[model samples]
Target chain A: MTRRLPDPRPQVEIVAGRAHVVGQQCAACGLRTTLVVSACPGCRGELAPVRFGPDGTVWGSTVIRVPVAGRTPPYCLAYVDLDGGPRVLVHVKASTEPVAVGTRVRLRGDSGGDLVVELVR
Target chain B: MSHQAAVLGVGTSSFGKQPEVPLAQLAWSAVQEALSDSGVDARGIEAAYVGSVLGPFGSAQRALQGLGIGRIPVITVENACASGTTAFHEACWAVREGRYETVLVLGQEHMSSRITGAIPPDLGDPEGRSGLALPGVYAMAASRYMARYGLTLRQLAQVSVKNHGHALGNSRAQYSGDYTVEEVLASPLIADPLTLLQCCPISDGAAALVVGRAAARRDAVRVRSCALRSGRAWGYRSEHAWGFEIVRETAEAAYAEAGLGASEADLFEVHDSFTIGEILSIEGLGLAAEGEGGRLTESGHTALGGPQPVNPSGGLLSRGHPLGCTGVAQLAEVTWQLRGQAGARQVEGARIGVVETMGGGVAGLDGNACVVAVLERP
Candidate 1:
């Protein structure tokens, strides 16, 4: 609508979590971006980049029958809502079977060095 | 109004998972149409710009080989869904820059290959190396928009229904028939707010566009502007800051260059990779008021005969997305509309048209790259 107005407030802090996600907060509007972002897409606020805090419940998920570039079929992926409230989409770490929506997931790094979510304790 | 980009010719092939037809054969069909449409010989052109999402080894040259279009300098351009549009941009640029008078633009894709099935080991930096897929990225975007805006699943389903109906009239589109909103809602939910119908199908096809400088009558549509840009500053903590917001930002510039506002444009051909994407694109490009795109769809503003007809060829929704051919097809569709060539799906007395094609790996906040162009017949 409005040309991506700048993010008036920018906040990002990398912290410890099962799987890390970038944290975000707006200073001007006090809007909290549930996921780590570079800028406030709504406002032109420059975001402070950081890692995600782990311990999220599955907001939703699906097993991808569509294969990855070099991977096998039935790749597990999901959107996890952190215990702290931010939601992020990610491929759950490797497992033998598919993933379900609402599965409790722990965060961890994947083979490529990106933060990943997995079923955990 | 005579800045000088004429639609010399255009061509397109039926869209689908036609693995039976080799990639070159797919390109050849569109290429031949463009040459014949413009009434020009293949050798009359000095250069070529081919847009493709995924091509197997010198694919454009291979496709042209069948047409005896060898010995001409050809370059492949890849810009995700905007691949075709990107090709158009380069051809127009060549004309504007006064390098060549006759240039060919093409957009094509062949997703039926192994590329669609496996992740490229060199997809991207560490972020992608860790394994991030497009569906999840868009799914995340859908989730955030729904949660914050209170957009309902029913509203999202309406998008698929509307687009499905639009595609029904497109003889070249892959999706057919009318679907009820309820039926869409009842379809399998691949993502939280997105159903299977909401997403565009993987396709293999190509489209050719012939745009060059030529004197014409007052009715000729000139290439008003083809503004391409990458990166916009959006401040969101949870937003995917990885890719650029090229579509919205570039569309803004393109509108300015065209000496018009988004409202002045009569029709739009945008990249509807996912149905929700259409909503976001309209809002992002200033075509609709923010938080009002979905409502516009519900209100029938994006229908074929509405104030603004979007994706008349069923867009990527009904029209199959062949990477390289998409942009050419979009331009051809727009040209036909401007020339009053679109039959059943034609927007009566249409004059101005705009196209938005954005592609690349899905990131946290926005599309990776994009190209937006504005055209008019005066």
Candidate 2:
């Protein structure tokens, strides 16, 4: 019998059945960041974990043709600005539809707990 | 009154593949050239600063060891691509502060052996997990630039055509040609709207500078100011964040230090690693008004011999983006232009010159690091 390997963990924690990306907000300076840090880069304020949008606007995006991290060619990537103030990087699903700036997108959780973005047609 | 620092000499190795030569030897070649150019012997060097990213850890010690420079205070800088100018900034401060009379700054990279399409990202960052890299980030910017300002693909290709044409006169540049805009557009696309010709090729090269106190040499170029800024990625709140804010702030600081404004610059050497990069950087640096960079280029305002020529050295697009070497190379080119030494591609009567170098990118940040400086002919 072959042992099952685990999927890669999500970059940010997600509550069960919730389709939102987690972010951290500085309690003092009100600065928000998608990446987790002990102290705020702005004012050295303490950070508290917060949940951001289930949707966002695609600020900028590209479909990489070269192989990246065992991922096949032609996978889409985007800098998605959440409905809230935070911005995060998301892997868009493979589709013929063009992903341009300002395109609306929704977040979905994969089996690995990673969030993938889908075009909200 | 503030102290002054001057660049006494500058040197650079041929910027292309040099796998047959060791990294230290490549650095020593540039070092020897700098020592000869400055007419200052190795004995005159009081301290050294080394800048590199992927090279060996103690590359400074190894390079100096190969050059037979006896013990002197050496510090290695690894501020991404800004490492070279970062070293130069530290050297200028030392000279101005009276800590060292003369210092050497060297930036070297060996991309021929260890680099390919895009640099791999650390998995610790979520963006890396999402497979976001340099090309993708810049591509996103290109897309936004196109959407926000109505910039066309043809207009962007013109930058490559112009820079490559300028490189024809530069014997040290890795790539040179008289390509047309159509040709640039026809090249294979690396990222959307950015073709092969539109992206800077990776190469192995080295650039060195000798900086000293005021009036150090007969033809030294005065270091008016050097300013650096790191990313406030987490704090920045904008969908259109293309790292321009950092460039703007850094440029403002440098101008304040130099007691001048963008209008005072006769020429510029910007971080044009990609076509859109030049467009965004020039605007951010205040060379052109916001959202007018592409229009300015289209109008031939940024070309050589224009009111204010930019990247007369062909920039990273044609000169090759050898990482650590790029920033210091900008200084060398600007120095030559200011001293009336840059032939063929020189911006005539260039008095005030600006050099901007930026590097490193993380998932949420605009840019990991940036360096900007102003120089005057002396």
Write down the RMSD of all candidates, one decimal each: 7.5, 2.9
Model 1, residue B327: C-alpha shift (Å): 2.0
The all-Cα superposition gives candidate 1 an RMSD in Å to the true structure of 7.5
Report the lDDT tens digits of candidate 1 across residue range B231-270.
Answer: 5433223343223245667888898888898888889988
Error of 1 at A22 (Å): 11
**True C-alpha contacts between chains kept, each model in order:** 0.15, 0.43
DockQ (model 2, Cα): 0.42
Residue B366 accuracy (lDDT) in model 2: 66
- The TM-scores, one per candidate, come to 0.79, 0.94
Which residue runs of candidate 1 sit more than 4 Å off their true CA positions?
A1-121, B1-3, B115-131, B214-219, B232-245, B362-365
In candidate 2, the residue pairs with backbone N, CA or C atoms under 3 Å apart (3 or more residues apart, or in different chains) clash, namely none
